[model samples]
Target: MKIKVIKRRGFEEPFSIEKLEKSITNALKCAGIGLEEAPKVISKVLEILESRMVKEEVHASEISDTIELVFIQKAIRNPLWLNAAKCYVLYRIYSDAGKVPAKFSKTDLSLSFNALKVLESRYLLRDPKTGRFTETPDDMFKRVAYAIAEAEKRYGASESKVREYARKFYEIMSELKFIPNSPTLMNAGTPLGQLSACFVVPVADDLNGIFEALKITALIQKTGGGVGADFSELRPKGDVIETTGGVSSGPVSFMKIFDMATEVIKEGGKRRGANMGIMHIWHPDIEEFIMSKCGPEEVLKNFNISVAAYDSFMEAVIKDKKWPLVNPRKCPEIKNALGKEVLDIAIKCSEKGVEVKWVNAKHLFDKIVMCAWKTGDPGLVFIDEINRHNPTPKLGKIRSTNPCVTGDTRILTANGWVPIAKLFEEAKRRGVIAGIVEKEREISKLGEEKGYETEILVPYGEKLIPTKAVVWKIGLKNVCRVIFKEGFELKATPEHRVKLKQGPWVKVSELKEGDKVETYGLWIKEATVERVERLGEHMVYDLSVPGYGCYISEGILSHNCGEVPALSWESCNLG
Candidate 1:
């Protein structure tokens, strides 16, 4: 017998268990309920309701009430689940009453109205039954503070000491002194406590490696995280594939696979995830990679393309000399070539002859600048400068940075990584720097074949083995954008207003890369053009400032820069 549900209107519709499952799943995300377990919550609620009501027709309100009852009961025993239940109920009430709840527990913090809404939507415990906020801003602060502070307990801190740290954390937050990243704030103290905001997954050159990275990318985005990848390792277009005896499609073509996947996964229909696509300056397909995002419609919107330049490349540009572009497969570091060392490698391929092409350094640089002038993309990352500050030389070189966070975290390594936090606490008690080596030694003893990937702990007690192909694992803080704003479009071009101190002020339509510009955000700041792109009628420019990167379209340039005067900056993060 179909369970017919009466809607707020007079119409009747069949009840959908899938619909109920989705509701429960969304509510559980508020508390870190896994896919495997969240369905059980829905089954429990449905079971309870069916036992009480056997009628052929039931009001939607009655169904809503039964789910609420189940939520209330479960939440009481597992207090963390209360947050999920709260959101469910609140959303249900709003549905039935057609009004958002006005009464909320008051907190001492002085917050903007918009800020309060953000806290409610993203941070506060919600009525899981209704998908609404039930906890206040104060409640969120306490939860996050206590959760992060608990990490100190791993340091052998006494109970009193840990509690004091938690108190201090709460004080800082309540005073509006410090705030964690979105992941920390949203998942903290919850069962799904993934603290990192971004993941840099490696896309190995081979078929399985590429798909494996794609799989990891999907998993990360599903949890509302971003990813960064360097595709310089993949062979260029028209390269030979020995295994299939076919020509290779190259990195730019393969990127579409990741791009299409992103279009579908799209962070569970909430927000499409973002990616950083980087290509080395000397890669055989550097030109193709740079031009990949160039069409009128633009390809790969989910990605931020950048050229990974080394100091030597810039030196070649200054000297106006021919730079050698090497085939990625020919690097001397590649010891094993899947099978018997292929004789026709990049060094001296009998079929293709020498795999090196020399192009005017300045000419290549100009191409990057010109493309960037049209599209605010293919920015440059000075790899030499990045590796200079790396603390872990033993791990390997840093190739790219995550688009979701700022600065180089220097956690780059080959062949995946042992979960830091999962093994970190136990490792730290043993020692500090030496303990990491000790853990590596310990893991190594398990045999490379058998212990290649170890199941590691994640927030919310989820066990996962990190991807082996990844070369970088960035340390992340909550992005201010996700914390305060909701539903970010994937790589939407931003409109920027330009005010030049004493030059011709024009809209983005006329803006070009390498233009000196004045920027205003936190006070005022000086900025220079890294790249620019024309998306239809509007021109977008990527700005490089002191510490970070920012992009905007000339459409936002309300004031003419021809009349403004130059001055010092208060603060800025555009890169």
Candidate 2:
């Protein structure tokens, strides 16, 4: 039963039955065929190959021909076995071209396994009829690059120039010098040409205008574009609808419709639909708008909610003044046709209800802050700040921010620390952290053993740059919020350490009340530790700071010495 098979390269090698069976199995799997008869089919193929191998050495093609001949004969016996054999036949072609490699070798274009999974699931071009992927990742990049470069040819480039630009574009992509948005990568060179990732749809007051915006929003979301809309123009709840002779459902009710519509539409059959809803702070239903995302369950989870806030509202909040919330329909000037067009006003069907609510601006601002703390929604958009540099004010005010916010490079901001790679870049500019980073340019690949993990550097107090300190600190760290079960709490980090007029600066973990030796202020008030109790994980001590504020673990208490009386803060934060 000893045999040697000849390869296409004219080389002789020992025949492996395992190899043949695995290849056939893969083919069957690719064709979505069952493996019930696979063992029998592989056995039969083996028998045929052995019978045909009369000589000590047999050609590989002969083995293939005998297997295929058996397939033709099996077709006469039963169509089931023949289908499996035919799958094997097609698998041969697929393996030679479309098969993903068992392993990715080290190369510039090589992708990670998960990256390949994502691309294979969606981005790779497939035959619509067969539902089989017809192109590889390299093919996708080339398709996207060439399709975009073709735009140059539309303006007046020759065929040669177009090809040259295509080559340059291909090089740019292959070298990882540039990458376009996901929609472009997916739809380029395909029938669907929509490539943008975000759209700002304007919602108008009337039913016609409102539905029109909803239609356009649906169209954009269907094509993988996220949409943002300003709902401030719509009248508040209980406002009259002149056309229908009924009360309006209001902007929030319409927002629910938009949310439901987005839920129904799956963007590009791959990405989920996304939306952003913005309402002005002066809207009469501002309180209702602020509390929209609160209290347990949610219907508009797909949306990123935001409030359009101006400097005047913030000023009112600061001065603790009663702010006027006005209905656009109430004023005669606002209701006039010319005023309506410029200011976006609509007539209320009746005037029986109160058109304005004068609320304490501080209370409204506190509510917004509290809701935002609960769920990371209702991000504030500073209206005055945005328009301070508006390029075209003549066109009208910019009401809604785009669905996606694009920024230049990676920069340090109030949001934690920058990326590790960004930190390394800054360190290089300052001539630091090279020894810490060594040669690993990619920060993600670094680990805890390498003196780093996933962490960002932020500022604490003074000019001190601190970190979650996992990686070489990016910047100073700041203590933002102290979460308490019902009161104040602090972690046992070195940052929570406070100084005493004795020994060295000790951690809040070590000291308790009645153990203090030094006077805090300009003179001693002759006070001993009043009380100590454990609230959850925090060991809090009563080192009363005149303001009824107690110290925890003797934790950093000086910084929070705001004489503004003890307040029940779910998240103790200072601006």
Model 1 lDDT per residue over 1-575, tens place: 37888775558999888888876776666456566767677778777767777686778767766765776677667765666666665444343334444332334225543465465545565555655455556667888888988888765788888889999999888888898877677778878777766666656667876897798888878766777777766877888898989988899888998998998886523467788787777678888888888777668978888887766677778989777676656552211111112122323442445457778989989989998998887888765555465444443322211212122111111323222232323333432111011112222121111111111111111222222211111232222111101211111122223445345444433455555554322123435554453332211111111111222221122221111110001011112
* Model 1 global lDDT (CA atoms, 0 to 1): 0.53
Q: What would the TM-scores of all predictions be? A: 0.51, 0.49
Which tens-of-lDDT digit does each residue in 387-446 have in candidate 2?
Answer: 455454442222210000011113232353243345333434543111122232222222
- What are the Cα lDDT values of the candidates? 0.53, 0.53
Task: Report the CA-based lDDT of candidate 2 relative to the real structure.
Answer: 0.53
Cα deviation at 404, candidate 1, in Å, is 34
Q: Which stretches of candidate 2 lie over 4 Å from their true place?
A: 1-109, 331-354, 391-575
Instruction: Return the number of clashes found in candidate 2.
Output: 11
